[model samples]
Target: MKKRTVADRGADGSERPRHCADGMPNTTMEVHVMHKSIRTPHADTRRRAAGGELIGSQEANGTHAWRGIRYAQAPTGPLRWRAPQPASAWDGVFHALAHGPMAPQYAGLLAPVPAKLYGRIVGDEDCLSLNIFAPAWASDAVPAGVQRRPVMVWIHGGGNAVGTAASYDAARNYAAHDGMVVVTVNYRLGVLGWFRHPALHEADSGTAEERSGNFGTLDLIAALRWVRDNIAAFGGDPGCVTIFGESAGGQNVLTLLASPLAAGLFQRAIAQSPVAETFSVHEATERNDLPLESQRTSAREVVARLWTAAGKAPDVDAADQALHATPATDLATWLRSLKPEELLSVFKPGSVGICLSPRPVRDGVVLPLDPLPEVFRHGAWNRVPVIIGSNRDEYRTFLADKPEHVRLLFGKLPLLRDRAEYITESNFYSQAWRSLHVEEPADAMLAGGHADVWTYRFDWDEAPAVPFVRPDILLGAAHGMEMAFAFRDTAGELDIFGINTSSNRAGRRAVAQAMGDAWTSFARVGVPRLSGDAQWQRRTHGMAAETLLIDSPAGGGLRMAGVRQDIASLKASLRLSPQVSSGESRCRIYARVFLWSPLFAGLGSEQEYAELGREFGCAQPASVFRQLTEV
Candidate 1:
């Protein structure tokens, strides 16, 4: 037997710590922990890339989970606004048991939940962690001929500002039952994660990928690197990794496709209703509704304004000048020095009409000047088998929001006076329901010889309505509704759709089964097939866009909606819609729903909103026009 020799003890008999392969020092001692969540007798031993061993808990259902594992070091203090660094090595066995802390965010960001059943939570800066779930079939090792399951890395969506790795618990998903592995990740959020300043740019001596700003994106890249290096231990194919995210997470997935820094980290990708908007860094940094360009907001301007308003500085202008003159290193130090609360006050949610958080920058280094155009037109992005889709009723979640603004501008429409109304598929005055969301971007990805781009439209709207004003209108497979069905995550089951008797239980179950299988199958072989044997086809031609409409209400089978037929249907719907004004304005009630899609954009044009207003006959109040002029 080869005897393991350690360095001799010091004069005082203190043992020397062993060094990790990653150069992080650690004590050469193993830890034994019986994770409480482990219901099974057998625990899996997984080794981390940084030389830490993990005792993963086995589920009663024959699955295994390694929760709250830090993919990167705690991004705090000096590391606050910088890219994520490597996680340090630990001497004892790191118990991948409890979920990690989430990035700091405002409360109530989650889909409405039953507080009694699922407790409300806060966040912390020490939150760059991830959770891995593998099927019971995926033991520590597989035979030479046996294939390792594909890894699906989940990035939760809360507008790149909120949400955590622990937000959705899908222990019952296909990944846990089928031959696959799932990983949910947490990255920095809000001002802490995406903030960038001209001053912080001073010390950027590293490569373009090391550029500051968009630290949240950087954290994601870092997590992907960690997964690529370490997911094998969990019985995953490091090479065959797919990143799937919804909403903001979907946007991140698309961004990753465009990011040179994130190249080769992932293979296949799925983006669910990504917030598709790309603008220049200046366009992002500037204020939306403000009058003066000089008063446009950025981290520097906000810090200066907040400091001056708080009486720390002599005045606002002087503070701005001082901040501009501040050294780059000192600028980062000073920004980190300010109270998190104070910094957040500068750009709180709903401060403006929009959720204008610090957007991902188009810094010449990390992100190109224009990503989508370059990718689709110039062909400069990481091409992979991609699935991009959106719900049938996406704007329903924010229906009341836009309508509320309209109500505030022009006195409430008599039709929707009392109701917190939004656009819907209801046949209001012969107008049929239509949606253009998430389709335009999908069309942009139909480049030949690039990737097999499969498009989908989730049209089931049988979700249980919660406290939302109108369950009928607000709960139609709205934005982010598919996540629960995709991961089979029922954490917010009760509050999200009131699972008791309101929701279609059997339908939800069926949809969940189909979607889960589709996702897993896609990860397995880059194609999504339904249980009923209908294949999801790709859109090859520009106008011949074909999508697999994943719907249960219309029928429990795949309904292929070809773009050619869809265009004809849209024209028919528009022709049926009234073009002239009627009593109390029919356009006000239906324009947002039927005319608000890119598919229907040519029909609506830039004058659609005005045309709708004209048809309503109830011209927008003079006050509303005045308000617009003032702005």
Candidate 2:
């Protein structure tokens, strides 16, 4: 099988870990407690919302914070792999302070997300919770006919396998400063988030939704439902909500955009660096390797491999056998009984150091057949306004350690920031790799409706990137770097999510100001402003694409250039070129072939010099090209 080049990080190459550790018995009861502190608010008796009473905390800044409030029933014990159930209302005041435990971490579970490249997150199964950041005046009680500020629900990125709502705090910046209600969420991770089994069908109540393998996605939907029902008290307008996220979280937002289950949950969305990969149930589940094996793909078979490697967690290992040999009844029982840690080591990285276990399944019931095809093919449930974009350099760090051929295309050796050495990724340059990301969807959304979509390329490259140590390799705005600017407040300057930036960049603060205004503005109204001065044009297809190239120079001053190029038409032309009859005129071939050619990215300004008629040694079988086109 051919290897895939880009995803959210290779797990961003979407969102893994696998395998037993020596000596320790990794199991359920023995599950480790996450240590990240989720602060409970100082006691506030007067104001409380539905879901019983929530004890709130008052920040020094006068912002009200409510952390670690459950939004769904725990997916533990018999509830494992089931669709999330609404959180049972609590009796006493639910202490809204400390963050709840995040979903367990494993190769199957990913964390530090795309933007969160550093930080230790403690994992737990009881992790479906949300934190609320509301202004002092925004109480849960709102008079009928009165309206509150718009709401923004944040989803954190970790390759899809691992990340926690506790990983970020948007209260001080987004809510307190912007005067909007902010909600950060914690969803299931790794296998707990996405998994499917044929035998699992009999376990459900026969409801299509019950047997779904999209728990993480369901968790997000549930949070939105909670926001819609209860946000007014928090001083938020439930009818006007925007969902935004970076990396895997961004991909989730995109998923919500295409999901029938998520229709009407939010009126607007912003997806930053969304991983463009999706999986089918069989593709997600099927694998054959190791001590206990099935010839083909099966959830039980996948689990049995974990059992054999980890020596059981004792539940399923206690069973007679795995694979086809295990009875359906026994399999279901074994599945429910398997410990969290027991399942932890079942996944590991391949020879090239990429973990492959965590991904959402496209079960026709909950998730559509394919997100890209469905939304691009006019299959969206809510035609909401979308702000979608990618950074100028998305996959540099991932390429830092890959083979030479891989590096040649995606890498900028040491310091050479601009002018990438060669087009290594079949095309060349990491930014070029991301062009398809924003291009495909933005064009589709525009074709669907005007002003319904906006696309951008994040170009802020001033920060440290280690930055003092190695600015050269960091190149132009790398993946997940724009997040701090987008979610932060201007006063503090420093951000909670640790990304490297310094005052040295002349107008760094200006960059943050631009992003903050854009994000908060979009949340308040449908339209977003990249900078105070620049006008953001809606992206459209065939028509010259007006992409807002957001960049701030060394001295300062937000440079928002509305570059015009018909990326949609260019991509469309590339898709059509291979079909033209052979022996065609050079002008026709020159027009399409060279642009998409593996050499295009490396060509730089020499595009006019490149000749398509010349025989190039590097060419895939014609059938492969056609197959890829079909896909």
Candidate 3:
């Protein structure tokens, strides 16, 4: 190792010991410089792991963090769609200072790029890695009768298409103050992570996991296995692991719960703003001849696009014929040889930054054939303690981008056109999200005889007032708003909307403390406990089901109520609300809520929309609104 002397200059230009080459302060120089001031020196941040020796960095918060620790081999060359393999042991010390590359994806808000490279692919195919953060004393010798710290593994959310482990700073708060080991992981995204085709399966020699096309799911499972085998070196209890995430990460949390292969990998789980939806084998592979942009995610459609782009076929018909005539081995080789950017260019991203790709597939191997709800209802899932929730205004953040509701000024600031209509529509869709993500899943787990389920609704919507821009109206308790509080992220890691302000800092800090306490408490034990009299209760059956409301003190604070919603009740309330002006407006809201939302997308059809309109005194057919919205 290269040796260097580093010091801090005092106000008088005198040298002060700050860091040494061995990762410890120069105690002799410090004692002579300041005779009265002294402190215990921190241990060197070097540790041994199964893979090799790792050297991490110490943070300002007195925590040790290791980034870009390879848990699995890079999925490149012929291993593109195969299950992840464990990383081979190395010979020398690995300096884990920076994060590994994210999965290949288009540059967006989650993974931003330079202005010149906007909308371009900006990641790598060799992206399977994990990060770890622990307290400074984690590597020290444990005293007698003391137990290891609980582990919390984080999975980032980017529609399961775009995100990186480096985007978050886990050691700043969660690990430094909460006395727990935190882990952030990166898995394959978009088509590379979850593609299903017969040719690729033939290349892999017919392995069940490879044929399932759930490579991302398998990547997460491999990470958990690595934690179980190696987390003890970081002073973590592998048996007390908790899997948590928001948005698509939350969706993956639910997927792991229902996966038989993920059994015993974790003892607790927290899913925030999660959508419980999965694609079937047919939806993942079969060609959908629909004109909508979403139908192009299927493997058959992707192959046709690649074929035409590669000049191997003239049109769709010729592409289909060539695909049929090509040998399975040749097709697999051609797919492996294509550049990552070329494969990513075939699919377009939605306004919300999510690519049109199938999520977790129900392939009957890694995941069950039945839907997640059915699997939980039948007690076929890994029954662990769970906390599930959604935001109150889940759809406002999404709807703010729609041209009809809000118009952008200077291509940045937002101006709401109709506050009443925007709020009404946001309510309908947000309630639907809550019902599907929280209520139904909680009810299913209860039915499966697992009563250790807690639920919450994030309702903190106190954005400071700004002229011309109404963040309070545009982003009121919207999706992913609770993550900053959940992780105690005072540095604004998850605050992409710039909702934080000086006026709300105190309230935000209070809420963050309460939430961080509750989460750490849950990881320590199975139940969640707060500091004050606000005791979070479990979900019960029947009409008396209760949900904890998480909010700031200025916004009614944290409380519990017996509030529940379902599709039937939501439609009924929409029909009665005075804000719904006309049949056309009501149909527009219905189209967005039922057809575009991930929870009900594939299940809802035009026939159901028309039937709903007729039953509620609206004479407009569903096609009229569908054509207008192009949904």
Candidate 4:
């Protein structure tokens, strides 16, 4: 290993440490000079590059934490809505002392009555920054190689609108335990990133032609490029990299899979609940109803309307200046000055609102076409192994907020919600009904694979006791619930999954260990394998295969029952039925009966159950149930 000296910057940028890769300077010694007062670039100690700074402890892990490294120049003035440009390199060792500001915030869709109270404050225009957390240079945690440790690039999620990489705390997973270099990045969000214009596309012309949209995704690619070139200095292996995320980040991973620019960047990917959708530039442009100029025209009109409403001359430059100089509080107050309906009419219209006007542009270059079609075609990605699945009650979070609202839609029968709610509530009565029941639709989505999809239901419902909300009563493994388990993380005053009891804790730990192992192992090799003979089976596209359920005990025994067969029959019937879309198919009709039939069977209402099945459109003989016995 090359010897190095490091030092801490003392306010006016002066080095402080004496000499210590090891305390003893003779035997196997190397000194990391904390800071060199000289302010010389390479003359300070070790490797030199562009503007960079050291962080973390050299003595502890030989890892230097480089905070807020700029990947792109500030997208302001003329550069706004234009493609990102590489940041200009600096001469001396510039200080990367603080995290760069996040992208300028916007009042998002449905941004409450009191606007400031609705969402987070907007940040700076120069928000294209990244944070690196790696093992310090002198630590024993460094991977055994001439190259540095592997890198894991994490992209945070906020519906492609409201999240930041800074929100995630890596104290437990990436920074402390994994021992790999972890990079969390920030990019433009909402309109700032996804805005488009015909003039902007025309500006690029034939030579330096650029896509008019998907700038946020391009930012991710830029960050990966930075990692490929510079990670070696921080003892990170550039070759072995894994890109992982959830929600929009998951969507971003799917986007990366389809992006030709991101072709050779990542070795493997894990997409958790990737949303399948199609976005188009034409569709995006239509949202604003821009008269050929897109957002610029829209912005101009909005400024005119706002100024006129405020009884001032509708001066565009003055409005722009006001927007720039005004405090966040003032912006909210100014916005509130207008009537809600008046503001909505001018800025937002019907469902196609201003806030989501120009979303991730589907320009031909950066985003060639609809990504979903490419993914469904399967050849678009490099065919690298992928791990994809959703939580058990994936749709539960969607319904959790409004029980009355949910009842309006789901309570009307010939649906799965009522039955799912019943089965979920059945757990309170006894463990008997809760034993090994699988929801039909979830099973169908898992089984109908175009790739090697590993399915899991995060059933570790160990939440805190709030009034009216019971873990068993409401939110049975809701959407996004698995994120906590996958990261094995906790949030809020209490751990988000307040799994208090020893049994619950043990279950959480076991599931966490299983998931963490699956993730890291998949990153290392292409396939994720379990420790024992407990193989992580690949769910095929056609047949209903077994899924590894991460329940109480880590490697608990498999389900002895035949729930998959029942699900398979239901799926097959739906595809064959003529009444499929009408919500009255035999499959749908039988599904409800299947959930409650066993209950009636015990009460000698077996004949009544059979007659009910006839009413529900079960075309087959119902008496075959009495002939079969449990193994």
lDDT values of the candidates?
A: 0.60, 0.60, 0.78, 0.49
Candidate 4 lDDT over residue span 1-631, tens digit each: 2222233445656432221121111212222223313222221223333445333322222334555778788766556555678877766555554556755443332221244434334566678888776544443444434345556787765556555665543322543445566777887765556645333444444122244556787888888888777766665666666787775677677677667778767666777654434367665543243222223223324544566556564665565555555554445344434432333333322111123223455566666565444444533443344565545554444334333213333542122235443443232212221221222222333333334445444455555344434544355555455665565342221133333455465665566556766665665545666654567776554545445565545335222122233433443443455533333333333332342232112222345445544655555554333212110
Ranking by lDDT: 3, 1, 2, 4
Q: Candidate 4 overall Cα lDDT vs. reference?
A: 0.49
TM-score of 2: 0.74
Which candidate tops TM-score?
Answer: 3
What TM-score fits each model? 0.77, 0.74, 0.90, 0.63
Candidate 4: residue 3 Cα off by (Å): 24
lDDT of 4 at 52: 51
Please identify model 4 stretches exceeding 4 Å from their true place: 1-50, 56-64, 91-98, 106-120, 139-147, 203-209, 287-357, 375-379, 403-457, 464-467, 490-503, 554-631
* lDDT score, candidate 2: 0.60
Local accuracy of candidate 1 as per-residue lDDT tens digits, 1-631: 1112242345766443221111111123211222234332245445454548776666544466778888888877877777788998888777777788877665553622234422223468898898887655334353111255677898888767667767665533544446567788989877777766665556545345545477888999999888877776666776677899987798888888878888878778898877654446665454343432212455656667776867878976788777667677776666777766566555544311122356577776567677563555465677767888877666555443444333432442212334323342323211222223255455566643453677777777764444424454544656667787786543343134443242566666677777877787777666676877677777666535387777665455566776333334554544355542342334443343334321122344326445645644656532232111101
In terms of TM-score, how similar is model 1 to the real structure? Answer: 0.77
Model 3 alpha-carbon drift over 4 Å, by segment: 1-43, 112-116, 142-146, 290-292, 543-545, 596-598, 611-631
Q: Largest lDDT belongs to which candidate? A: 3
- Worst-scoring 10-residue span by lDDT in model 3: 25-34
Model with the higher lDDT, candidate 1 or 2: 1
